[model samples]
Target: MIRNTDLYTIAQSGLRASNTLLDTTGHNIANVNTEGYVRERTTFVTQLYGGVGRGTTERVINTFAQNQLRRDITEVGEHEIYSQRTSTVDNLFASEANSISKALSRFYASIQTATDEPTNMAARQLVLGEANSLVGQVGTMSEFLKTKEEELNLELESTINRANSLIESIAKLNDKIRVLEANNSYEEPGALKNERDKAIRDLAEIMSIETRQSGNDDGITMVNLTSGESLVLEDGTFNLFGLNGNPDIQYKNLELRSTGKPTSLRLAEVDVGGKMGGLFRYRSEVLDPARRELGQIALSMAAAMNEQNRLGMDYDQQLGSNIFQLPTVSGLNYAANSSLALTANARVSEDGARDLTSADYQVTIDAVTPGAPPTLDVTVALLNPDGSPVTDTAGTPITQTYTGLTAQAGTFEKVLGGIEIEFPDGAGYAVGDQFLFQPTKDAAADLEVQMTRPEDIALASPFRVDASINNFGDAELVSTTVTNTVVDNTAPFDPDTSAFDGAGGIQGPGVAPGGLVGAPASVVFTSATSYEVRDSANNVIVTVAGATDLNNLLQQAKGAPGYPAAWTALNDYPGYDFSLQGVPKAGDTFNISYNTDGLNDNRNGLELANLQNKDVVLSSNNGTTSRFSFQEKYANIVSDIGEKAAVADISLKAAEAMKDQSKNWFESVSGVSLDEEAANLVRYQQTYAASARVLTTAQTLFDTILGAVR
Candidate 1:
């Protein structure tokens, strides 16, 4: 038979379990609003003698829900940062009235006014004033972007400090939790683990992170930053963090190292995330690119306008000077010293003068083998606006590699992007040395109107051309003028068709023109509809095969009556134009020669004014593409930024939805409910009361038996 003592012990055990259950429920209710707190549940195990009886109660928790929640939170954080930064840039560029578009229109309108009244002092003054305003506007925007970059740098530093602080705090908590867990004191150390987890979640808000729990149950949690770089190890050691570069001109990068390591590694090598990651994205994708594109427009306008100005004579009959001055190209060295020298120059390509992109290039001296026979390799990589390497459609990096560089240093020509990189042979390049080329990065800031006097504005052509006076036929030269020599090599010239591909060639893509730019030419008529354009040496530059009328013949050079034919510019030779008022007989020849009139010729200014519609900007791939105007390029930039901002906003909304859903799932599994906690309180109270009654009954029975024995 079971002893009365055993019965008393069972009742006492039941009472204690009920009391503990009540306490656990109350604790959950108390911390329902606490962040990162998981609801704790009391579980009872039955101890059997002859019958079942209540034994001990323990606390239980679900780790899976907590891990999922952390991951969702990290994704939400990344999207938020990206969305906010892009929105700022989008707003900055979206305005049309006060933005670059408006400024360009005003400046061009002023130029038109000056073109209409070439001798008007007031119109000329307005042109100079508008040019100054345009440059000022560019400078203001550039400075604003620079200011934004500095602000991001400050934010980055603060974020780094916060990340480091959380890392250290978690490591300290790890030490405490490990000691307590080792001693099997789960009750007190559970709170410490909660604190550490909160720290992890906070750190995740600033960057992407991955965590794992140790199998040994020593309370160790490992954390890895972007792309599997160790942040906090399982043994409780966290990596140290540092920064490199000034951040203002970019190249500011995160550095990381283990506690025991002497050197730090670049964070860019790893996939970085969080607030710091967003800053990097903003700097490279928005800030740096805006500045570069601005500079590219400034450079294109200044270079082309000034070159055309130089081709004309000033009002006083003197040669024209630059209207706007800036560097031909912009370049920077990774490490600058007195011994280091470099030149990165860019010019309009002969093909079409298509506009170059704002993208930068990296030149690196890599893979050096030093010995009796030293060998070095040079590699160049084209970078996207975000500072990431550009790739082909198949995702391979678009890189050019040159081997067997025996010369110490020389100009590297034949490189794409219409640029030449020159290095001084003295203090030759070292292995691993890198140079960055930002061809138009500083153009806006460096632009200035070099001309001071109104009389200095080149409004007249420096050279003139006239038809041969000895032509013997009904053919008579009607008019002559210079045309812009920049021709599109890809544009087909067909006399039968009214339309012409100004930059495209009839043969195929990128075909070189046969005519020489600025060279004199002679037009010899084989018949009324046929003529051959010859250079000074009598070599045929292009032959006009079929022409129905004078207008058709002038517009298109056809191979046959209906077939489209390629025609080179008679002189890419915009110095002059020859015209025939009447039909010309066969064997009648017209000689086109440069004009000696420099003072009273406004032909060059008129040609320069026509450049507003000419495609003179070079692109990344289109060498002779002349489609986009300077204003059009700025318009494209505005559109692209707006689209990116919209995409970022959409992504942010989606991420937020995912985060909310994850939190809801976690709450369903582990969140404390007030209604449930209240029900548990009442149930446990009743259990305690019932257990007391059982103990009293057993005691009463024992007392009665003792009295009977007495």
Candidate 2:
């Protein structure tokens, strides 16, 4: 059992095992700085009962740690991109020079000064200057947002290209790896396999991916996008493509298709995560909303100012014209039918401006047949910044349905949210026809001052009251004022411009249809509280029945006959409501007409300046609608971006820390450490020396036996 020859053979096996350990140690030391190189170790086994067997070399790796590292890497990648982009916008709004708030404040201050000096041309010029400055600021911010969106598009294109390259590289590696595994090339993972792992990690930096082994022992990796699609299978690779534009053509859309195939799949931005996710996320969450908010501010402000200026008489005496041309936006058609002639648009009225939010909308033609128009109904839904359907408070989709709208080409139908989803009644629409409307998207750039001359600014009301010396009655027209502008029309519509501007002034409040221009309207009190309003022709236009109080009488007069059901008057379908005080004898008469010489009257200017504090900017709070002043709205925009940036910053820190921790655990198991390798080298060298000594002793004993036998 203990023969010298047997001992020599066992010693020889020990020496071989120690030599393999030394070689593995040296290999590890040599690759200590190599990326993804797993440490190698020599494992020895015994043969039968006594002698040592050949050594097996295998890589040191932990599957859990590698997966954890991959997850952390993906998270860090997304946060890094999102944080940087969000901070850019946050910093822009935080600056005083770039902020819309400062310019807006200065703009309103100029108007405040003009109201005090109603006839001053210098004050009016200052107002125009401030308006230009404010417009410039809005344009600058909008341009910045557009630039950011363009930059994101470029980034997406680059990301897709790089991802495709990595995918191809991984597929190639898979092909080589499967070949090697098939031939039993190595006892453990070889350099090619490690290189493939590193390539996959790089891919993970762009998108969320999950890796798994082949179930049938293919030895090739299968990568899942984690967004519910297989990115790479054991046998095939998929490539990502960026469509040049989406429905609006403002940015790119991502798609996926197999290599060498025409069939493709569209990827939703919301469903994706990683660096690509970060870029789209910042665009949707920060830049888009910020741009929309800026446009809304510009649009709403312009509408309000234009409305008030139109209600006043300019120093030129001709009815004040539009001070600023209303911002016009035509809806974009999508998924169009070649024969569908229907189109859509939006308009915000002076009053409706307060109801406008920066949300995007879609008008869909349901029941659309190839040759017949959709007359049954249309679906309108508010969209998120990412073009996703906005949900209601109960989480159900908030879709506004309008029925019985005609499908007639060239005809217009009104829909919710001031949207004119007009189409003819009976013309067929193409299948999947729809329209996209962004009410304020273009306002910042499209807004223009329609007036250049300071004399064009309106600072006087068109109506005034006087104490009639012709009336022997003791009633006096004490301190009369114009509460709101008048609109005298059967079907009043302000789709774009002010309905009451220009020729609209020819029919002042209480003026009959086609009445003489600038004629005084009369109100003769039948009783102390009961008065019948009449025009120059003495046509009874408004009648009060039982009025104990002037304010109460005004409310009761809202049900006045001869008015249409869809009236848009300032007070209960009336152009303006009157507030009369004191006791007046029956048959007392007072007249109301244009304040042509009202140069000293700044009442309209006061009202216009007061618009600065009006609740005209629409906002949402907990699913309820609330209106904010321009300042509050602008401040909200700045704060929202700031909050998102802070969140992105925090997310980055968390993601990086997690990645570092996971990397530490992974490196401990598979990564080669120079110090550890050096120690192993020394240990293996000593073991080899001891093993050689054993071999030498075995040789001596065998030689002794051989000499003895001789």
Candidate 3:
């Protein structure tokens, strides 16, 4: 016969296990939408088997899949964060580049207008106005870039703070989980695990990380990220935290709480690869390089333009003066040294004067030997400034050979007017006097110069003049006729008489009194003979004439056929085409000087243009103009984000599919469908009713037996 007690024990144990399974299913359904919540399952085992024991129900949950899901979730979080950051920065660059392009267009338009009306005041003013706007735009754009960098800094700080908080929370969970698992708690503490997983996901956004479960403790876990360093220990404490300060992301180093000192972390040294790794790589390499390149462009443009502006220019017939205003940029001052030489060719005058057109001259200055005489070579050019060969008024090409050439060391002083050439040791000069050089019999000349000076020729006063007049003539004195034999005090006209002689004939005062002479009524004089002044070496000395005032002379000289053009050429000229081809290594310095007149006179604009082209290179530095195009950079950022988003979406979808598969599989093994649960409920109810009926029968039999015994 079946024992009633054994049946009760079996039914009760089955009921308890079923109830637990039902609770677990309800928990999973309720928290389905919760982030980081992994579906849970109850674990059960058959009770101790007794004699004639029937089989009991049991269920077991899969924890390995839950752990893998946690890791994937962290990766998804990190990828999202990095994608957002790069996208933000890329957008900023796109905006800035577009603004720069607009400014460039406006500048070009102004230039076109200037070209149309070169001499129009309104046109010139418009050009200047547009230039001002362009410069302002550059400055504003630079400021905006700096502002964006500041924003990044703030974002970094916040990220670090949030990471630290998450890490602390994670450590706390670690401790709680270790204790709960050890105690074999009926409650799996699934909520705490979910929170911990969320924290790990948050941390992954800042840095790529890896997790390892501790072999010593079921709940203990270790976190390893970039730089091959342990971020968290198995002992439920964080070993690593980020420093909060400026957003020098490139120099980001983790600080160990135990040491309280920052440790260098090189992503390159670590194999940890993820979205956080991508962000670190971008921060350290791409973004930083872009910023540096922009700074270099700004500094080079500013310095070069400023140097050119300082050269000054003449406008509206005025003397040379600064043409452009330059802004001072901190930490970008350039120490410049330049050497220049001035030379001129002789040309003939139409008035039968000595022609300077054929006389070729050379001038040289060396910076290394400032006071030393420069090497000079002279050559005559057959052509004029108009690129046509020189011809006399007779339509025949006239040529002349220079004679009595001489050269000596001279002190060249640059004054406001121009460069003043002085004799060496001040020997060939007189107080308040001047000297000049004239060419032979031609009207056109060519001059060449070799400069060795380290500094630019400082132009001071332009011209000098001296004027004095003297007269030579015969003279006679007359007195009224006095018959009285009185001594006539009037001097008499005598060409051969001495003033001190007392002869009876009238004596002329020595060469007229006070060295003065009166004009004769009518007299024929011979033509004045031309005389030439020569230096020690018999070279004819020439004097520059016209414009007695220095300032006027400078103004007139500025745009003159030869001298002015030469001066303008030097104003902003970039000296010789020097090459670094011969330079072997760093710390090597070379000295070179060339005629600036051969180059552009306005160097500021040229330098600015050169900077735009990335032509100016610092010593030991190479500059690159290859920048990420708007479309390219933006596309890269967008593509990266889209890829990660897609991957995350796909991963979540796959996880969902897997969960469904696991649910179906689990249902086949242990899950209770509505139909099956209902059937089991009915079967259990019937069994309970049958047991009650059996008990009633037994009671009736016992009562009958007891009555018979009574």
The candidate scoring highest on TM-score is: 2
Q: What digit string (tens of lDDT, one per residue) describes model 2 on residues 1-710?
A: 44444776777787787778888888888888897788887787788756677776778889899999998998998899999999999999999889788888898888889889988999999999988888888888888888888888878888988888888888888888787777773465567878888889998888888998988776688888887677777766656555545458885667787666877887887457789888877877788888888888888888878877866777776555677776656777674445435555565654456656788888776664334444646788887666767665677666788776766655566665544555543645543667778877767877888889988788777666664666655555434444345454433343232224345243443332322321225677788777776655676656665577655333455466643233323332234434556677777777655566778777777777888899888776446677889988999988888999998999999999999999999999998878887887788788778878888998899799999999
Candidate 2 clashing pairs?
A: 372-428, 373-427, 373-428, 407-424, 407-425, 408-423, 408-424, 408-425, 409-424
TM-scores, one per candidate: 0.77, 0.87, 0.48
For lDDT, candidate 2 versus 3, the one ahead is 2
Off by over 4 Å in 2: 1-12, 49-51, 239-244, 339-351, 366-378, 401-414, 419-431, 470-511, 514-520, 538-543, 552-574, 697-710
Off by over 4 Å in 1: 1-5, 49-64, 185-188, 245-249, 267-270, 328-331, 335-355, 364-381, 385-388, 391-416, 419-432, 467-601, 619-627, 698-710
Cα deviation of 30, candidate 2, in Å? 1.7
Q: How does model 3 score by TM-score?
A: 0.48
Query: Stretches of candidate 3 above 4 Å error?
Result: 1-5, 51-79, 92-98, 108-119, 185-187, 244-256, 259-282, 285-287, 307-312, 316-710
TM-score for candidate 1, please give it: 0.77
Would you list the rank order by lDDT, best first?
Answer: 2, 1, 3
- Residue 374 miss distance in model 1 (angstroms): 20
lDDT of 3 by residue, 1-710 (tens): 44445544555555555555555556555664666555565555544462222322222334454444444544554444445555555555556553545664565465455444434446446645665665566555455545555655556556657766777788888898888887864556777776786688567655667778899846666777645577777866566444422112323433434323445433241133344444444454334434433433333333333333222221221112222232211111111212112222221211111111211122222111112343222222232211223444555543322221232433332111011222332222112221122121111111111111212211111111111112222211111111011122234432221111122211122222212221001111121111121222222222223323222222333343432222143322111111111112221212211112322222222332332334332211121112332223233433444454455456546645654564455435433345544565555566556555555665677688899999
Each model's lDDT: 0.65, 0.73, 0.38
List, residue by residue over 513-604, the lDDT tens digit for candidate 1.
Answer: 33232133567889887887655566565678666665423334333342212233232322334456688888778765333344445666
